[model samples]
Target: MRMVAVIAAAALLTASACGSGKNDTPPPATVEVFTWWAEGGEKAGLDALVARFDADCPGQRFENGAVAGGAGVNAKQELTRRMARHDPPDTFQAHAGAELLDYIDAGQVEDLTAYYESWGLRDVLPAGLIDDLTVRGKIYSVPANIHRANVVWTNPAVLAGAGITTPPKDLPAFIDNLAKLKAAGVEAPLALGRDWTQLMLLEAVLITDLGPDNFAGLFTGRTDWRGAPVTKAVNDFTTLLGYGNLDRDTLDWPQAERLLIDGKAGYQLMGDWAAADLEAKNFPGYGWFTFPGNGNTFQWLADSFTLSTGASNITGTECWLKTVSSATGQQLFNEAKGSIPARVDVPSSGFSPYQQSAMTDWKSATQVPSCAHGSGCSQAWQSAVNAALRSYSTSPDPATLQAALAQAATQFVRP
Candidate 1:
């Protein structure tokens, strides 16, 4: 079946170029695809996509340009440097929403509205997602998958040992469970990682304390940052931080996930990508629940690929984008990545249990974007929030953190 698809793709590639006088120049031999999927489940997903690219575009080599970091924290800095030097990769991974605004504003990424029309993507991709990918009526990237951010991955055995039969439904209940887990000999009842992971936890707590509408409003200036609800959320976040590991400042999400996988911690609040990692490592009896107080809401983010404005290999880059936007590519990538396909037409028959549930929730739940994952706000706004979080992590002062956040909104949030 795979071979047949490859042969068909090759025939289509040949037929499409036959009548065009523009085919005088041979296509580039290799396409350098840049991303931060350097390890664990993220890497597995990228590997699957690369395999699909190899099969579908047999003439073009797939050059891996992966940089290591959680949430592309390090990779974004590297990408900035590359872009400044006018050496951007053929295509690079980016978050699908407000994050792409930076590149779009700078004219660093090509307008992909034409590509979307040509590929009939508007027919298959969710309308909400296409809207998220657009800025000034032009889409700049092709989203690969939709990841739910408000998930609490659990070690079921650890919870059972702590005398907790069911997952917590609210912040207070969750805190109580943490206490029980700690009393039952768990070192860190909540496993947390550095900057963005901590930010993700805070966002989940925001959803709990403010509700989905209010939390989403925080990004759009519809909700005030100085409101009592935000203050309460921050306090709740600080309280939860106390139950996390002391080494959190030094670790990334994958290390924090290991704490739960090894039973040293009771839960890890993360995106559904953790499911892929747990499955990859063959960790048994792992379970998941929506983060406490986040019922019926899906806090979401999308990983997307953008074609550079002056990409050295337009043919190779378009080939990569086409493969990424296809249902087959989305199926292979999302199944391995523990995300649901961005394309609504992709079937959920063989996805993991967590992904299947996520797909259902994706359709019915109230959806909100993730600030930590760059969907809810601009990169500058997210950076300002992260700065506040870094200071709060060390000082544990809720008031100071709240002040910093309000100030960030003043500086960055548009009317």
Candidate 2:
């Protein structure tokens, strides 16, 4: 993919090009960014980063090529079409780990290892996180934030009203808490939304039941999918789902969070990104706890930006990547985005109370990759698991779900 070819192909998809020449006077430099963050705190974070870019690089301009969709549902589809047509943005957002394999395999992304070295990023970012972003000893992207997946958000007023003195620390206690919440007339004790949210809840349960080693093995091919632990986890997930909202399937993550905020629900098991949303709303009486029995663990997901192969403005793209990896850029973005900075050196003063705790926990916790958010498995495997779980949601059968998950592993796992 090259500029000439991309420009030629862009004629067919009119709104796809960075320099479409719709304006009589083109900017001296422009970095067109493609992402799924169209609304909420995520967009605010992007605007902050763009502001940094504008201030730092006087001549350069930021072009938002954002498409609206939760979890990049529509953006990914359009990005695929643009990439296939050899018309790619200067930079595009993607999950950091194995989710990037598809772009790398297709030769649609550029290696960013040299940039990491030149910018001294190896010293600023955690070594383990940097290793996760690298493939075959080379890097391809700059991680903007680290999101913790296995978090339980609580409305303090709701919990205190139900006479729950403390957050659950184990599976048994968690179930008991749910029962207590239900007994208190809380209609949705555990608020869940859509298929991805369901998967997030299921993975948190799997981590609690299987322990960190076994859970990590599920992704690394060291754990047997048909084993009793997996079976028990599936059963546990089904039991957990019983307390979810009746209209979960129709709502997205934010809507489900509303149940918790509005005092209609007691708990929500979601990523730290929810904290940013809550903070933006000046949400009071909110508290957080690690998901049951997973206190010493962190289920990690990172959002990163990659340089596309056929960028029209390499200089502008490089400038964007530099800003993304800079300490100032990371701190400002993560403070608004509700995630911890990828740069470990950033001071904790920039984060909110919840985010400050997460930053402290990141150092000591045993990190596990997140499948629901694209760190633990390939996109194909994730799709398969999602299908199986969505089916399980309707059927509510544990054995069937376990068997289906085992089959998906067999098909997607490599030798």
Candidate 3:
């Protein structure tokens, strides 16, 4: 990987020198940035990157290719169709690890170790984020932003209404508080979308409260899914699901956001980016707490761009990756994206208070690639988790969900 980066850097230097020596007119290239960031906080960040790229890389037109869906659902499916037809965008978004792994397997991405090395990322990028982007010592993607997933967005009024004084610090207390809210006649203790968002919320709780080391172990094929810790997480998630609104299955994150926006729900466990949407709604005076956990460590996932091999324009595509991962670009991108840049060296002045706090927690913590959320686990495991938990929208059966979780945990060991 280091050798590939060295050679690529040398090649870029040679190309730059040779190009600089010539007065030959180069044609402008059209670059398309495909991503699942078409609304609220995500849209802002995507626009910021495009604007910066347009300003710096003159004549490089960015095709606005934003698809609306949770966890890159529509975009990933769209990418498959494009790759099949040999027609992919100049750049597209992916969660660093498993998503990129699939593309690398299909020979659909460029090795970005050179770009990473050129930016001196070994020293500047956060180690956790770097590890997530790397596979077998090689890098295939550029991290755009660190989206911390373990936040519990709470409505202060709702919590007060339920007579809960402070955020719960452990799983047992956490569950008890939600029960309090439910008994207080709160329609939803957790403002869940009752789809993948519910699953994401559950994973956040399990990872943060359960200890990141134990959380990491689960996916690396070390932890036993049939055991108490994993079972507790399943039960906790199902119990939270026990407090959901009957119509949750139809709600997207935004609709769920609206509930918190209107002070209709007591708490919603989601990423910090959800706060960005709250900010946009001019919703005021809400509180965000780390999903109460036994440990103080945090876990995160990064959203980044992966160039498709089907890109017909290499120069444009190369430049796209180069500028997006640049220090200035990372800052601008994360600022608009409602998160922080993956680069550790970037100044932290341009973010909101919630983002600033999340960054502080992020600095002191560990990060793991989000398996079910971003890693694009196997279709079987994803379906199993979905099938197992989907019923929780109404059922909330712990035993049934636990059995399903145990069965699905077997899917991740690559060997």
Give Cα-based local distance difference scores for all models: 0.89, 0.87, 0.76
Clashing pairs in 1: none
Model 3: per-residue lDDT, tens digit, 1-415? 9999999999999999888874656656788888898887788877888788788778577887778787778888888898888888888888776556667877988888887777687897777667666777889888787887777888998899889978897778888988898889887887888567777877776785457777777666677777788777776666677777668788887788788777678888877777777778897587988777736656577787877776776777777787777889888888877888777777879877887877776777666556656653543456577777677555666777777777777754542
**Best-first order by TM-score:** 2, 1, 3
TM-score of each: 0.90, 0.91, 0.88
How well does model 1 score by local distance difference test? Answer: 0.89
Model 2: clashing residue pairs?
none
Selected candidate, larger TM-score, 1 vs 2: 2
* Tens digit of per-residue lDDT, candidate 1, span 58-106: 6798998999977898999999999999999999999989888788888
Top-down lDDT ranking: 1, 2, 3
174-276: candidate 2 lDDT, tens digit per residue: 9999988999999899999998888899899889889998998887689988999888888888888898898898899989999998999999999988887
* Off by more than 4 A, model 3: 1-27, 375-380, 391-397
TM-score of 1: 0.90
